[model samples]
Target: MKRAFIPPADSLIAFECAARHLSFTRAAEELHLTQGAVSKQVRQLEDRLGVELFRRVRQRIVLTDAGRLYLHDIRGALENMTAATRQVMSYAGSADVLNLAVLPTFGTRWLAPRLAGFQKRFPDAGLNLSVRLQPFDFDEEPFDGAIHHGDPVWAGAIAERLFDEEVIPVASRAFRDRHDIRDPADLVRVPRLQLATRPLAWRQWFEHVGVETDAAFQGARFEQFVMISEAAIHNMGAALIPRFFVEAELASGRLVQLFDISLDQNTAYYFVYPEGRTMRPVVKTFRQWLMEEARTARTNREAMLPR
Candidate 1:
């Protein structure tokens, strides 16, 4: 690699730290160097870049227009480098380190509990997890694979079906009793809780249960299922929630299922990785384990639901 365009590492580090603190003295204190040393480093960086990164006005340092733009980009680059280093540090000797992204709620509620088994099966494998709510490009991110929830369409990645959801309408016991929700159609009469991401969720649920009403779209919208579940528990309204997510609530009697019929989110959960990544040992091992776990989960779910 050509080194001509690259600024000195010490210069970049010093400049970035000084830019953040806006004080050479403070930056020096943080770096455990003298203020003069920090100032000299910044001067050398400015000379190399051929642009004034900091300006002194009223005896205080501030960023120039070019400085502000460069700082923004450099911060991102530094953060990415730090993240890459951390991911590398996760690896040991010949142990495989698999970095996987997953939906926040699903990772916590569904996948977390079952992860112990994966560790047991693959003692030499390392797993690093990050939360992702939507589809992402594997090339742009450092993730080896991701657990996605949507249609099996991820541009350059191949998606392996994980499991679909079984959504049930639920509400606090008090709310259900007060409203006397006897059937699936009774949900339309009450204030229905909705998800901001899944705006048409209620309408789809109604369509699944063969119930038609104008009130389907009207409700208090929430950003996440946890919030919606809490709203339902507080007697806010009936919420259509995935059964697995509310198992504790249902079991504890905090919420009750109003109907036996479940809405299948046709867009199932999937384990996706970039093309050609299946050749990697870590990716392949985790994928097989996850697929088997998902199959077992699906089978158990199917057996329990009212037939």
Candidate 2:
């Protein structure tokens, strides 16, 4: 079906590149074309759309409100198209391709290592993983499923629990020694690292241990657990991190667990897929394998805990 409202693909490419750099010359250099050619393509695209995308100011260029909105939607379309092309180009004899979106740190640490087992179990199946920090619309994205870290809530999706999140306070041995921290209350005066995504992490951890402090809200914030782990390793501050993530550091003596107390988050990690898609052979097999892995991991964790 031909859509007259949609501008030419090459023109969209020109517009995207020029809008990104705000300079036709830069866009031309990247696209391996002359500046005039890029400008002509963008002008044609604007004419077709009947809207001014870019506005000039003192020889520089900036996107108009329409340009910004178009860029926001088009960028994702381009990336998804690129991903689809790559998936097709890289295809082998695999029967089913599983496209998954996962949390970055969790994907790197947990699922990645266990992937060998899945590959061996289903040698005929292919798996692709992409990093996604939060929930997204499944319809708009080219994903078969996603590993979500929060609540069991996704529209038109089936949520299966992967594991519970339990976070504990940890710090470098040197930091602990320098601060003379012995009890949960002692942490209030020292540098505390905060997770930017969950600002209430420290407050909740403190409350779990029955420690009161107004300073829980004050600290250097890091966006991800990996960053917080690195900062804490350098003695930047004490950080509250998921226990599973810091096991290696704790064993290596790089980071020390502060107290036995931990905060059990109300939220848990979940493997979610569109409800109707569960009937697919690939999705069903993966769900079974994931639940098994989750059970094994949970068992091991519980076994190590003091009885």
Candidate 3:
């Protein structure tokens, strides 16, 4: 496809908002511009496309099929442009800005709540959260530090051990009642829901319970742990997920432990920074606060266990 000359960024932005809300007036309000200005941008964009994109009915604007398709493509491009601009702006100045790459669920459940304390302690520092899907070249990225899983072997970075990991076989109480899972071995007979994030979770859980089941690989596999937990809660299957994520479900009787089998991942979470970044103030503050938070979490998790 020929790269058609795109409209101005502001014009494309206005068109996207208008297309999404299906209202130019609303888009104008969001953009903090006059209705006439919004209309002008849309007209500019439409002219650039040489196509009739929107239908002006009695008092409303509706998208044509062409408008919908263009909106989809342009919206994505506009979003990417916005993100790139933000990233560039963020890294412009100040060593006090701490950009942390974190695991998605772990960041939300464990790290995010403690960030307020970190902010209060280092008021001048700006804490930024970036999600790490898999191991990447940290040096090439603009991140200040990363809270990565596994050992301290990340090339071109200084990795400090944070905390060990654990997973338990869990399911909804309703699901437990419906299925005959009296023993850990019985889990093999049921649908074994799997989390794509932790590919080896079930195998470790089975080893803990002294079971050798190849069907561990079978069942629905979801990318996120939270999704797997939800599927388990809905009686989809048994999921071996991190203990922290399902605390509420376990306490509220929404989910239950199928067995006492708990296996350690052995590899702990690590606070990793680019090789030459040990003296950075923001990175140091973040690492200190994170380690303190991890200590608290370990104590709390220990207290919650049966005596």
Note the Cα lDDT for every prediction shown.
Answer: 0.88, 0.88, 0.83
Which pairs clash (backbone N, Cα, C closer than 3 Å) in model 3? none
Q: After superposing candidate 3 on the true structure, give the runs of residues whose Cα lies further than 4 Å from its correct spot.
A: 1-81, 88-95, 303-307
Better of 1 and 3 by lDDT: 1
Per-candidate count of clashing residue pairs (backbone under 3 Å) = 0, 0, 0
Predicted structure 1, TM vs. truth: 0.88
Select the stronger candidate by TM-score from 1 and 2. Answer: 1
State TM-scores per candidate. Answer: 0.88, 0.81, 0.71
Tens digit of lDDT per residue, candidate 3, span 1-307? 3545756788888888889888989999999999999999899888887997899998899999999999989978888878878876775554478877888888887788678998888877766788987667875787888888877788888888777887888988888878878998888889888877667778778877788988778888899887888898888988887787787788888889988768778788888888765567777777788888888888997887789
User: lDDT tens string, model 2, 1-307?
Assistant: 4686777889989988999899999999999999999999999988888899999898889999999999999888888888778988655777988889999888877888888888887777888889988788888887889999888999988889989988999999999999999989999999999888999988888888888888898999888898999999999999999988877899999999998888899999999998765456776788789999999989988897898
Error of 1 at 301 (Å): 1.5
Question: Residue 219 in candidate 1 has what lDDT?
Answer: 93
For residues 185-256, could you state the per-residue lDDT of candidate 1 as single tens digits?
A: 788888989999899989998888898898888999998898999999999999988888888899999999
- The lDDT, on a scale of 0 to 1, for candidate 1 is 0.88
What's model 3's overall lDDT? 0.83
